[model samples]
Target: MVVKMNLKHVDELSGGRKRFRRRYPKSLVPVLGEAVFQVAMKAREGGALVSEWESLMKTYDRNVAKAERAAGVAGADDRLSPLELWREARRDAAAMLAAFKDDLTEDERRELLGDELERREADPVLYRAVVEPDAPEPKPTLLDAKNMYLQERLEGGTGRNNKNRLDRVCKRIEATLGPLNKLSLVDLTRDQARTLRDAMLSTRKADGTRLAPASVRRELDMIKAMVSLGIKEFGLQREADNPFIDLPISSKGVAPDVDSSKRDPLPKNVLLAMRDRMREKAQVPALGLIWRLLEGTGCRGAEVVGLRREDVVLDGLYPHINVAWHEDRRVKTKASIRSVPLVGDALVAAREALTLSEGEPMLFPKYARENGPDAASAALMKHLRTVTKNPRHVVYSLRHNMKDWLVLAGTSERVENRIMGHTVGGLGDRVYGGNDAKLKVAYEAMEKAIKGMP
Candidate 1:
């Protein structure tokens, strides 16, 4: 018979996977395997194994009696002593165990181990064995389906160094919800998932700083993904709900992101001041160009940093730069991989960068490491802080201010979205079409907006 799990709604859920075990007398099952014998001894040491032991003994004796009657052993071996009959049963138990040991596979062992841990937590005999004075520490679990998902992603070439992030997420999951580390997929109930969500919201960094709503939200997302692995790879329980799915992460009380630099529009005056400052400084070869490109083209810092000599087509009829993804580098989105007309300070900066890095494939080689985009953002952030001399004004504010610059110039939202290399907002948005007339209009609007700078 399959034993129901110890989960909150185990009684209600059908077809539980746990085993229904019956204990037997040690002599009748003389060799259940050395490991099993040791565990039983440890359980008995604390006086907790007696009931299970007696129950198994009775079951074994009853089964042997039925077998003897079926073969007419009572009449054929009537003179055989009771002690001799038990010895014969012991011989049969040893043969069965030896056959089981010969055929067990690694996959079966791991599943059994995870299941055993769940039983030990509540079983009096096993719980006593667990708390024995010199018992060995329980082993860490790394065989779960959630961990298997991580392994597949890490091995697959789809994401770059995503395993490290996922590994940290796994550790955080274990720390936030202690039982999750040891639980099987079916054992993870909806109620436990709800508890984990609250735990993550209240969690703080090691330095005692509470997580931002976005960070907490990401943690919840990761937890959901982990649980989904079990549902997708194996299967979810039909009776009990999977809390990771359809659970709302309520952001009712959390304030909007107060940091002005984060997706906040920069005032036009401060935007111009930062632009003028970058232009004034000529010591660094392409620093000014990077900043000016962000302001004029509305392109991300990484997109500018990853530009190749071929990408910067100053001699072309349109005089625009291509922002396509190369093998060594990546653009944020497919829309972000389009040509942006070089206008105003951006045109001057591009000409200067071409003069400096004439033969080099990459325009900005310093930031074009494997993860160039992230590095470029960091580089620009420091420059913005230094040039503005204000904690509030950031390099990213330049991109934010560009949207207003385009709209205020009466540039259609459609054209502005294309020029800015942003995702289309409406249902009938334009596809990738960089005709000369549209590029010229975008160039004129950008030039007009940034003209009266310095």
Candidate 2:
């Protein structure tokens, strides 16, 4: 007699044991590596058996969903070129072989190899074509290069904005060069690079204003970096033949004022005026404090706004903020990871901001989420507009202003570099000093700059 457990896919076996069995979808069989999944349930208790069955069901569902997503990404291989098809087949075959090897015992492995050898001997030509054809590997397309670049870069903890920017750059590049899937990296040419440069310059926004040379330059720089990465990673091309490298933005057909747009350092008087205005009318108390921190420390806006409570070390011998990478935010570069001494107004602001934090994890809780720093910047820019009408005077200009302050204070370039988180001199400069020595020098330079601030 058969007993019913009332659970789907769970069956009572002859020896009073229950088993769970489910078949994978036909399309997903290759991805899941099996047509059916089965496991024996040793527990006879109803609750335990149900729990085991449910757990197995969840695992099956998750595997199926994951396989479906991967299959979607891969799409049909019918449209692929012969070389691309061969590469895909080779990768899939290798993955299947590895998985098969992992699951089998030594005896089973030997049996499998012997059977495969007999089949190979029966049809040598077909075996060679399927398993070991002597064809050159397919060159990676632009899309493939982009995927590989992003995979490696994102693994190193790049932030969301940077990833978004790379995506935008790739989209723009695709628009000019053609679909990335069809455009092989090896086929990219200098003429195409020039055309892309010219296209970006001529492109206009909804307001009918042409793209700035600086903006175009930044996009081109991104392209160059991507191509450079692709070339190095895949051995596709040499540095000398990189199409995107040193492609000058010709001004022959562009408007005269496109290149003139740039951020200028905020004058001392304007900086003071803005500080006073923020004091009187700023809505967010934390924003005002963030501004003062930026003014005093000369840090990037994101660095100041994205600070966590733990990053602010006011109790140390040198009260400073640790600018480092966290899950919520990423520093600009390796050099950007440094301790910034809190001097003058910055110290007062940090203390006040800490008090206002009220034991929250982030110093500025409202601006600690994704794209939080960007929001803070927009709000600060609104306030900055009231103080100065100059289009060039931006939030970043405060950093430039601090550089000038350090210069006027007679600080050495190395000291200023430490204070501002810029890349220090050569290898000797980096290797010779410990963190303590670097912090001491940075503190002195920052103190001088703050004191000398007009």
Candidate 3:
């Protein structure tokens, strides 16, 4: 007589063989790649079969647990809403019926579908899910909008800074509004926008100070741009106006020129002192050249740090540095793409830097990668601190110092704007001159500025 041992998911087969079989959860089938798992068992004795079954059960449990964790991490549940799952199941069922109908006779197709229909009938939710139609596509959330915005905007190879800014804004918004993925764009309201702005305003920095108004303004602007892009791109219609647009942010108690007010131009004595320190042989040659370039050309710290070997024109009629955008680095603005004539100490520094570069693509290879300008600024700031203890006297003070010298030397506003890469407002200012004419005026003004420098 055969003794039948009832075991969960273990079936007794022909010739005393046993097979371990289990079905994955419907939700996990896509992740696990199959509906059922089956493995043959070689053990024949009742005790041996039981032991093998226990081991197989443990292994299967582990696999299922791993798959569940993976599914959760992939946000499968979030993407596979009941409606989505229904749509997918309907498509799969139709495809299966069509395929089998082509290969099998009418009786076979009917038999297979009969089994499926019985299973569906057993679970009313499954039956409804499979039969339900015309479910709208999932509404896009803030996270979705942010992702799409980054994809489209960052495709052009610029916008790294913008991307970082947008990420920071999203993080702050989510902190107040909960998970961005859960906050649908259509549901966003002006009250929520005001709440976020107030929260940001109240937010304190690590240094125990409230967030700067300018920084708050920028974050708000970033959110506005993101929402505007999302509405336009997705063609989302809303009953209410975009909450982020025209949001009033009080600039009370904030200076109009907060950034400019924070930094003061280096005094003539301080400038001479820093120059003397950089002249020391023990000083870093590349840093010294970068400093000279900033002082002499009045170019922004990034433009000076991001210069390539080819950008430094040593043999030109007017030896100058081209501050144009390259694949490796970006210019600050359209006006920033002009050439800066090398005059006085800048000429000497560029020549030395060119030789030191040794034909490398970047003039300052140490500071030409991502965030290279920031690195260069930090290093220069550290060096500057050693010369002066004033909080207002920074590496960027050199630009202000050069501006002062240009003004004192009686350079025209156009010449000053050209050399400093400031935006020339009118069409006349922008369209008047060609490269050589601009360079000639810029070189003369820069020469006067350096001569007048104490």
All candidates' TM-scores?
A: 0.58, 0.64, 0.71
Q: Tens digit of lDDT per residue, candidate 3, span 1-454?
A: 2334456788778888889999878888897898988999987543356557656875676566556645555553343333334444556555656676267865566466657867655333333433443446457677667866765654333224676778788889878987777777888999999999999999998889888878898889878878878777778855324798888889798667466787999987888788888788326679888998899888898898878788999786788999988765668889999899998888998989989887577788777544567777888888788889999999988888888999999998888888888998799889887889888888888888888787
Ranking by lDDT: 3, 2, 1
* lDDT against the true structure, each candidate: 0.57, 0.75, 0.75
Best by the lDDT measure:
3
lDDT by residue for model 1 (277-391), tens: 7667534657777777777777877778778777988885567899887643456677787778887668888888888776666777654444555655666676566645655
Evaluate model 3: give its lDDT.
0.75
Which parts of model 2 have CA positions greater than 4 angstroms off? 1-139, 154-161, 201-217, 231-242, 245-261
Off by over 4 Å in 3: 1-135, 155-160, 237-240, 281-284
Tens digits of per-residue lDDT for model 2, 1-454 = 2212356787777777888888989988998788998888876533355456656876786567556645664533323433444564555444545566367864565456446845646322223334454656667667666766665665433234766878887778777877777777788888989888888888887879888777788888877877778777877655235788878876666555532246788887898898998899998998899899999999999999878888999886788999988755678888889899998889999999999987677888877644567888999999999889998999989888888899999999988887788898999987787888888888888888887787
In model 3, residue pairs whose N, Cα or C atoms come closer than 3 Å (at least 3 residues apart or on different chains), thus clashing, are none
Q: Model 2, poorest ten-residue lDDT window?
A: 122-131
